[model samples]
Target: DDIAEAVISLEIMRDRATAHREDFETLYAAMHGLYSWFLRVCDADGKEYALKQHEQLFETWGATLSGEQSLSPLESAGLTQESVGDVMRALSAASKYNQELKEQKERMSGAALNTCEKVLNPLKFLLSNGATTARDYRVVIEKTLSDTEKALSTQAQRSSLARLPMDELVKIQFRCLNPALAFRELVGENGARSVILTSGTLAPLNSFASELGVDFPIRMEAQHCVDMNTQVWGSIVASGPSKRVLNAGFKSRSDWAFQDELGASLKEWAKVVPHGMLMFFPSFSLMEAIVHRWR
Candidate 1:
């Protein structure tokens, strides 16, 4: 019986691992299922009654019922038919633990909801010319563990779970753009031509905006903004490349003969060398015109 409940609990958690909104629901259902099971096989008469109740419950719920519930430690013990005193103790302990878990879950949920309001509502409430009010909106995370900590001055960290049909993704969204920036997939240099780097702190943006520079550059153009919060940076480069290449995801034609002839003609004007040979036709139309003339 204990083993059966363990199996059921694992299956339930596995099913629910993808969602946060239904986390507690999963927990309750799992405990309820297991708890009901304990009464099912409690005795022949009680077991039959429990089984009937379970059948009715399953029928009513059908596939709508979650299968991702977990059994608490005490509930786990209660599932096993050990000593009567031991079983009682386990059930009592499990109930107490569940209550504490409920309280903590509620706390985090409320905190997270409030954080959402603070971040999103202001965007809607645009800064009017009206006066502003000061309220205690910041978080106050009170930890009672051995690790000492200071008062929280900002929002708390939060993780959200997205639920798909059979999968779940854990996501963390930044509430404020603080400290560092999160960049996406970087573009690679297909062929080198020119490269320029600049930053607000750069002594001379035109000279060379390296991490640290002692290199050669006769000219420079850069100045820092006195404002402690203002900063800007960028890069630029020039190159003369003339190369004909076919790369992955190129939605071109299947006419290999036409491609080969076009490549040969391009090699005639600009050397279709390994890497450094890029045509700088004014635009796509100009290139197409040239291609038409060549063909």
Candidate 2:
């Protein structure tokens, strides 16, 4: 009976995969044509803008850099010190904005590659082989199908919007409402001897186990090896060595003063600490920004 049910499920999955593959092919062709149009438009705009004005501006800037010309030309052209400063700041902002766009483009490309490899390729192979059994590949097939369906939904919406004439694109987000289903899929069906989950933050063991839909037959709560009184100590560092308040709030976290003070405090600690020290940040981006500034 179970084998028959599995065969039925596999048949349904094959039908769905066939439909999704057709839709993806159509969208891919449309996007390719649209992208070609975009490239032509960008090329025309670049030639017009760069040849007319930016060419001269860049020449003047280069001359100034090489000490072959003075700021007098720019000043004579009605550009003041403040105006030049503003232009530099604007260029800096544009550079950062372009960098963010590049990163987003790379992430989207990665997602497309994952869908092709995990969903489309596997589905294609299964269909070609005329496989009827889902017992072995059930977990992989279900996960990939779910991912492809979600991607197709998002792509369809985005493709519709792309057909319209718009200056900015609307963002569409897909969030998982039931995280436990994903956890259950990982641990429920697949046969394994034992699954051990170890983490310092898994304090409420009962709730964690319940969420995972798994029972721990043997549980152990190990004590800290270091003595809290002598070997281990903790303190709240409200201010840095420079006496600047260590406020890691959203607005203050990015401030140069705060970063400098924090770095200075860490350096002092590193000098005194015996073996090593561990520093934690609220977020990876914040840590990256601080480290970039230091470098």
lDDT of 1 by residue, 1-295 (tens): 2222333433333354333324433333434443344333333333232222223112111111011111122244332212223323333443344345465432223332233233223221111111121110111111111233333222211111111111211111112121111111011234334435444555644343231222335445544445445543333322112344432122232234334545665565365335565555545764674466567
Enumerate residue pairs that collide in model 2.
none
Clash totals for all candidate models: 16, 0
- The C-alpha local distance difference test score for the whole of candidate 1 amounts to 0.31
lDDT of 2 by residue, 49-125 (tens): 13122231121111001111212322333233344334333323433433454654322233332332332222222
Question: Whole-model lDDT, candidate 2?
Answer: 0.42
**TM-scores of the models, in the order given:** 0.15, 0.40
Reference-based lDDT, each prediction: 0.31, 0.42
TM-score of 1: 0.15
